[model samples]
Target: MDIRWITAFLDFEPAAHERATAFWSAVTGYAVSEPRGEHAEFATLIPPNGDAYLRVQRQEEGPSRIHLDLHVDDVRRHADRAISLGATELVACDYVTLRSPGGLEFCFVTHPGESAPPMTQWDGGLASAASQLCIDVPASRWDAERDFWGGVLGVPIEYAGGSYAQTPPSADRPMHLVLQRLDDDPPTVGAHLDFETNARDDEAARHQELGATVLDTGPEWTVLRDPAGLPYCICGPDCR
Candidate 1:
């Protein structure tokens, strides 16, 4: 798949904003961008090529349903930095997963090593530290959603479980695009994975071809409901 962007939909109460921003800033060595309106968001650049960015949004509702797979040359170094920045080192924080200051979760593995970085300053916006975002899907919809992402993103199913599905990154990296199945009625529209394609037409193409249903579409972006009726989108940084 020609996947270009990945996002982590976080469920954060408004009160955690200051601490979350400060924690993220220290981890990235860049300031966190302030929210511009009703929706909460923060971003930071990764410097040099600017091929990608990472972000976190405040979901004042409940549990986040999705997570991101971050690719780093050294998971240890990133984890250490995150700890120094006030991010708790959760159990199993090493090797595979880690949670941020605001309880935003992600996994890191050393596959598909990164190239040398260029010198640059953080622009206080999300950078592409992650290669793929994983959306949680319902068990009944596992195969359906797997097929949807496989066909829409031009990738193959990496793994499937009774309540989980794993997709591979489109970039030249080894990152798992994960999905978790829900058993009961959804309490809230929690977390969601987002993509940044080259254009809106491309997003529409996926919707048309794959069975990805449209939730909303604007001039700058488009929202879609996956097979599980989870929310997802494709938009530029400005839309964040």
Candidate 2:
């Protein structure tokens, strides 16, 4: 499968969509495109240049969460490939949704375009930027989850440490897919975006100004919840 593009979607409850859109736009330095879809549930964050890699979705149901979209030339072919590697189908239609063996949900969609926004540096307020999706997998499923993504994406698994493994992005795809082993089991496996920053404290403060609340902080990263209550992290300068 040719993984032509990658996008991180911010899924929010219908009631909280507007707040999520405004907060994300402020922090990422992108303008929200006009809504699309039958109920106007979908919109893209327009970067100053290049195609968008971030999108916002107003879901009628389900808790706020992040999911990845892998764009390919043949959605069925790629979906089949993903299923063969232990992904269970969730929805099958014009596009396909699959839950990985470890339980994180992702989808396969036909490539929309070829343009990818350049990796940006901290500009208006954020020191660096959101550039990677970290999938939190239970420790019991760690090895298999790593193998499944590596096989489906055709990328070598690089270890960030004993508990974290990542699939490095190619020149064409700008976002990294990371598998992180959690100490305790989560109700459901899920993913979240990570921002690499030179000034974690300053970035955290800016996020607060935009309606994000600091949930917790550690030496290397700070966990925060967006206005819609989705959790994401801001990492130290060493992150990429």
- Which numbered prediction scores highest in lDDT against the true structure? 2
Task: State model 2's lDDT.
Answer: 0.84
Show model 2 residue runs off by greater than 4 Å. Answer: 112-115, 118-126
What's the distance in Å from true for residue 205, model 1? Answer: 44
lDDT of 1 by residue, 1-240 (tens): 433334343334456544544443343344455555454353443333533344455556553245554555667765665565545556554465655433446555444334433322324433322233556555455565556445434467765545556665343332336555567534221246555444455545544455466778887657775443446666653332
What pairs collide in candidate 2? none
- TM-score of each model, in listed order: 0.39, 0.92
Error of 2 at 36 (Å): 0.9
Global Cα RMSD, each model: 19.5, 2.0
lDDT of each: 0.48, 0.84
Q: How do the residues 21-89 of candidate 2 rate in per-residue lDDT, one tens digit apiece?
A: 999998888889989999999999988767788999999897888888998888898899899999999
